[model samples]
Target chain A: METNNRINVERVEHKTSEKMKKTNFILTAILLICLPFLLVKNPVWAQKKESSLQLSFLKKADQSKNILLTVKARNEAGKFAPAPNASLSIFIKSNEEWLLIKTLISDLGGKASMKLADDLPMDNEKYFSIMAKIENDSRYEDAEEELRVKESRLTLLLDPTDTNRILTATVTQTGNDGEPMPVQEAEVKFYVERLFGKMPVGEEFVVATDAAGKATYALPKNIPSSDTLGNLTIVAVIENNETFGTVESNASAKWGVPLQWEKDPFPRALWEPRAPPAMILFFAIVFGGIWLTYFFVIFQLIKVHSETKIK
Target chain B: MKTTKTITPLIACSLLLFAFVHQTDVWKAPESAKAKKNPVAITEASMAIGAKLYVKECLSCHGKKGRGDGPKASDIEKPVTDLSIAKTQAQTDGELFWKISEGRKPMPANKKIFSEEQLWQLVNYIRSFDKTIVKSK
Candidate 1:
């Protein structure tokens, strides 16, 4: 009886120990799984300030492949301040992979600018992506910004259409074969550079590019010119565009009326030399058409009368 | 050397399986990807833009009806999921956007090509096939 009791007790103890061992093993496994989280220095309460990067393309004149990246970090004052001496890794996307172009430390103003003599090899060969990244910072978390810009040109052409001036904005992007391809359905805005600010040229705020990548607006008459020669700077811009950033081309045209012209007026019944000559031509055309019609009708009536008499 | 019949059949089966595996892969989007909401509004203008972009960029593999039966669908290695199917429609806009932006083999990541709003516009366009499925956020 003593032996049986002892055996039973040992069995029970062994079972309990097995269960405890399993429990301990599971608890240890759980701790091991969460060990990385616990060991990490940047916890939820002690996280660093987040950094932000902004990228922009600065196309020189009507052509050039130049890009500028801006990096900022939220300072103690909770404002975006220039992240000086920050390492910025610039990458271009090609073949669905990020090709690191260069790593340039940002200047004091947080501007990292670079000019590419040739276009980067893009996936589609037309549109390209430039990504800027600032990683592994001590005081700030990692940040990345990407800008997708299509290789394009904005041409501003000022032409005289009859007595009025027509401003044409053409947007062209590089095709697969490295030829100029017209971009359709691109929204373009026309602006006249005024002394105070930029004055929108057409009545409509935005005009979409046609199949030929052209948007034309007839310059309104009597716009005040900056100088006596009636020359004003007209700018064609594709502002805040997804494919094309704020691309603008300026051209000088004699579309605006000189201040002297605006003041002089006609001096005689408010009709000038140019207006009377054009007005005389207009009236002459109307009278000439009317007389011709009347003469034709009378001639037809006389012929009908003669024919009836003969019959 | 194996028997002629067994060897030929085994070789053929291996090639077939290889092709099948490559063509039929369906990757799952992460939880963060599923939680994304469509930022582009579902309006006539937005849908129109989406339609135009779809025709230009996604028409090759997705097909005219988004049925994954496009002309190039067979040529592509990855299985083109039918965009109009209920399985696809049940997914959130962000999930679709994530899949498009971060593609696998034979499917290029479109984030390099399109902007954020433009990808949302594509999601809106894809949603047009079945209007009843998507609940706008």
Candidate 2:
């Protein structure tokens, strides 16, 4: 009975080994069949599981625009991995000129992002493009990608009601035929136009446009106007709208109290604290020069008189 | 009535000839000015400068190769003068300089725009397109 049991156990082990060999052969054949298709690459997805420049996201804030670039490479497993330590150059095309804005190195995650300042030069066209390039990479080939964004327009109109002043902002973008098309659900902000910068119109920083691309707000009556005519320049602006980047339109309305700029009752005398610095400097320089000349002449006369005594 | 018919054709022909002569023949340089000598020496450097200045200042109306077929040539009602032909090349260097300096209605005067040396260089560039320039070289 013991001998019979041992033979049965050996037969079971042999059958299991044969089954494992067949399974391994099938998996190997399948991999070989699919090898050519995997090696044949599509450029969009071609990280070589090597390297690629990807525009991961664009963020336009109310007052600033941010552009993000993610550099990726293929790992040993043919999986996408961040290409760290890669150098990147960012360029913005304003009209016909390609201006280099920033050069950066990719972080460990193969990502680099830059915020375009409000003062970046822009043309009057409806669209602007940003390009990123990775050159002379030791491990991966060169990669470049350009992203173009259509700028949107914002215009504000003021209508005076019986008691309340109504201001409306409309947002639009250029369509295929280059005609204005409404950009619905866009956020806009209103500001009281000031000499140096802008003051927010209402308590809330931003207001959203309706389906018709219009956002309306009521103006407070107490806002002071710089001119005597009580005319206030109300500016409606869109900051960093994903589509429109930044645009503003302003209209003047006679809706505020006339602000009288007070002039000093007496003109500031020279050497006074409120006197113009330049004027005080000019007087000091002239008087100092005159006194210096007088002293020089007196010193020369004294020397001549002494010399005459010696003679 | 027959005399009127004959006179109409004769009047039309006379008007046409008068307009043609007014455009081509009326640009006579003063005798003393025509004899003025070009002070700019003829050299490769001058030729290169003349070529550059012509492209910037004159190429819009005068066309490349001085064929008077520039992109802006048609915008003017008056015909652009071809500089390559004998009609223009026959003029002396000083005469060409004066004509360029004192441009007519379709052409603005370059006297304020270009210096005397630059005008002479442009005159040399225009002469470069002439067939005689090739023979002289």
Candidate 3:
């Protein structure tokens, strides 16, 4: 009896252990499927969203004057959310050395503003660098903004209908968005090439954008036609020493209009002057010859009749 | 006698001019009238030949139903031309024969493979696609 009880106990224990093992296996499978979803739903991942940074500066600044450095940060919602304690740095080159001009944390409005002292002697041109950084443990959420001072960019759009003509030009002061910002007073100088082996020269024409951010210029009447039209270099000079905005934008387009011809049975020259005159002349000559022959036969017939009657 | 001779020559010249103009105008009228009288007739034998030829050659590129989606069409860079469109089916028999004999781009010429009589049969089969013929029958 004791042996039989012990065998029964061992059987029950083995069944319980097997049941537990099966339950654990099911739980593990469920967890494996839900693991990715759980990590994505974590709260910390939601707070550290991506941000975009913009940088701008004037074209020229006084040597003793400080350059105003503005940095704006926008979250994924496109709202201006304050990033308190976010680090910002501005670097300007002085005597060929990159010196950190200012360092500050973002304000309540997600913006950092500082005045950068001119490190090098002021000339007609100056160069500077600005950067803003946001720290996050997540590799994907970190953001940085950098600035580079180089040649200004120009974009020209010829209306599709105005194929060969330069309908208008747009000179924009490009910022971080790679687009021109609104300018109240901007001057664009237009130039054209000389025709008939004459030297190419610049013809200055000033155009300003209206309330609707567009500048219109009528192309010159004597636009030169050539096998290859060279590039049109438009130089935009803003009155006063405004250094932060784009100083010039340049663009060029090819020189001829696309011609679409209708299908015709005859060659171009066939229907012009050749056929009508020849047709008229042939009819006139034939009629004149017939008339002359009829008169001659009539005169001969009357003379013969008169002669036969007298005989 | 002199007056009669003068009138006869004038009458002859007028007759010659009138005959020349009239003959030139009517030169191609007979053939055109004959073609109009005998429009293409689609018979079962011609359609059967067309079906056989299509299965042997065209069905590999243009699908069995002429939807332009056959098995070999998947590998080709340019899609096969669909023949079910009314514009294609409305093409004249002569135009169809020319296109088939010369072969358009991407479609190889079948002139050497198909005899003239076989091509005419194919033209008859294509004409069956016209809705007017079915309605009239």
Best by lDDT: 1
> Candidate 3: which stretches are off by over 4 Å?
A1-12, A27-51, A57-84, A118-184, A187-242, A245-311, B1-137
DockQ of candidate 2 relative to the true structure: 0.00
* Residue A298 lDDT (model 1): 100
Model 2 TM:
0.32
For every model in order, the fraction of real contacts preserved is 0.00, 0.00, 0.00
Candidate 1 Cα errors over 4 Å, as ranges: A1-47, A75-85, A94-99, A104-112, A160-162, A195-197, A259-311, B1-137
DockQ winner between 1 and 2, please give it. Answer: 1
Which residue pairs overlap in candidate 2's backbone?
A: A47-A50, A49-A74, A60-A240, A62-A239, A152-A244
In candidate 2, what are the lDDT values of residues B11-127, reduced to their tens digit? Answer: 999999999987895788888879989999889999989988998888776665675645565456665677877889999998999999998887889999999999999998899
lDDT of 3 by residue, A1-311 (tens): 99999999999999999999999999999999988877776655456543434444433212123333323333343332334556665565445555666766665544565544434333234335455454452322456555544323234455534644554544444445555555434554444433442232235366665554456665644544443443333223332223333343334544432233457534335365545666778889999999999999999999999999999
Off by over 4 Å in 2: A1-128, A132-146, A160-163, A176-179, A263-311, B1-137
Q: Write the per-residue lDDT of candidate 2 for residues A119-179, one digit (tens) a residue.
A: 5554465567888988776666687877776756577777755367888898888676779
Which rank order by lDDT, best down to worst? 1, 2, 3
> Each model's DockQ?
0.02, 0.00, 0.01
Question: Which prediction has more favorable TM-score, 1 or 3?
Answer: 1
Best candidate (score: TM-score): 1
Cα-lDDT of candidate 2: 0.77
**Per-prediction TM-score to the true structure, in the order listed:** 0.46, 0.32, 0.26
Clashing pairs in 3: A57-A244, A58-A243, A58-A244, A59-A243, A59-A244, A60-A243
Clashes of each: 0, 5, 6
